[model samples]
Target: MVYFNERDLCYNSIYPHNNSWTMSRIELDACAECDLLLTPARPAVGDKARCPRCGYLLQRPRKQSVARTFALSLTGLILILPANLLPLVGIKVLGNTRDGTLWSGVLTLYREDMWAIAILVFLSSILVPLINIVLSVLVSGHLYFRRPNRYLPYWMRWLQHLEEWAMLEVYMLGIIVACVKLASMADLRFGFGLYAFIALLIVNALLASCLDPYLFWRRIEQLQHNHRHEN
Candidate 1:
């Protein structure tokens, strides 16, 4: 039997269904309610509900998510420097050794008449990571400092939207495939850059997940509130 006390938000009163009870609670705001669990249909004012977890509000981000995301993004940016500079993969076949950095990989593709693949590799491995990291850092820093950066939010939204295209892990997969195939023919020695690139992928994943657009907006709201109070 399903029943709820009057104090329970899920509970009901006047016309209780045969299988359930009713309760009443003040609905403060959608941002503070169980929005994620609510039916696709938007919640009406005065509606009683609670989030599946914590039962507080589904929209509110964990307080530290912003800081953590910023930190991870910064760390990823720092790693990117070494990942590109150091030799990512090395091949020593029959005592003949060859090493390549991220750019060299792109150049190799180009020299092999793999123009399309070269461009893709360049974009995914180099351009995309640079753009995503720089934008993430800028957006997070703006929010952290409580700066009035209208464009920062726009950039953050775009970064979040474009995350799937970054494909850092995909690049890593390509590297692994190349390494495996080359190792079969020659001795392969992974370099510091290869490990750094791998670490970068994990760090980038965490950075993206930790960033929450809603949380940044909340910061903006707080800044606005303070400005009004001052005025």
Candidate 2:
């Protein structure tokens, strides 16, 4: 079962190679319930538990992923509002002071004709976190309510795919780089937002660790079967 979300609306894989080709395709399996397309994993014991199709776990939901994703998502959400509202970094040189927020950096990139970089920054730093929080809530609610949707499995799979692109740690690295360069030029002040962003980064990592696409997909199939009998 795949839950209804933007995450379920697509699929694309990028293979590793010197001249790798990108395979962009939306999975279209018939909906058993809730109009979702479920793509099952080839189950195998041991180290290769990941789905060959999309690299999701072939087994069930990992308990560790559940705990980590939930904890991180909750904490990240809490920190998110403040991370945007508070000043990220402040710089003072020659008695003149300047402050930078998340938007400031994006805008700077935009003005420089670095639209691609700006978009990447926007997606990773802003959009991806929001999607992760929203998807986690929906996926968790579906599991908790046990109200299986046909699309649930597909959503779970796609969510994991989306999760990979939401690299909060990478964003943090960029921030650290910027801070180092800024510090060499002037006296810099780190603010609450910086701490919040760091916390968010840890939260994102935890969420990824806790998520298991396989568990959700299996649950979805069972749900569809159960619903058929009821009808």
Candidate 3:
């Protein structure tokens, strides 16, 4: 039997042992928000777990999470090059036509001696997004194929931390703001790159939705444990 202590914020499990009962604390799960120790009850498919004290979402398992994430991440990778290299928008001001690509934007900032802003934009917009997609593919692909990699834990850690730095949505918002500002002054034309960029953003969002960090961590642990036993 398992019971929770509301005052101490701990879950204790009791087991029968030779005409007696042994009580032990279960530390398998911890609430990410309130730091409450818990032995989480497994929720059924499409169900979720929440922290009792803080009301923070603890876990929500998705069906075929690994396969879904891998597919979306791979699609994002394929879309990224065109999203960055091709012209995103074209503008005509008094017969002077100008096309803007993501790479060109960063280079323009650098050429204007705004090196710091250029670097920041480059990292947040282009580099970080690419890294996140690649890492997602690597992690999900390995798991989907049942491959036990020693570096899986490290990859997952970096993926989670770097998620905050990938500002694709922010960049998209900036693009929208620029378009709105430029509409009155110039004739704006959307390009193929804009469509690809939008698709990439959608795919990234889907990938994030399909990934279950807790499930991935548990699977990784099981994989490594099984590998150790086999060896």
Deviation (Å) of 144 in candidate 1: 0.7
Q: After superposition, how far is residue 202 of candidate 3 from its true place, in Å?
A: 0.7
Please give each candidate's TM-score. Answer: 0.70, 0.67, 0.89
Q: Which stretches of candidate 1 lie over 4 Å from their true place?
A: 1-60, 221-231
> Residue 8: error of model 3 in Å?
9.1
lDDT of 1: 0.70
Provide the lDDT at 30 for model 3. 69
Cα lDDT for residue 1, candidate 3: 19
For every candidate, C-alpha RMSD to the true structure in Å: 9.2, 11.8, 4.6
Q: Which 10-residue span in candidate 3 carries the lowest summed lDDT?
A: 1-10
Which residue pairs show collisions in model 3? Answer: none
Model 2 misplaced regions, further than 4 Å: 1-61, 64-68
lDDT tens digits by residue: candidate 1, 106-134: 89999999999999888887988888898
Best by lDDT: 3
Determine which window of 10 residues in candidate 1 has minimal summed lDDT. 22-31
The RMSD (Cα, Å) of candidate 3 is 4.6
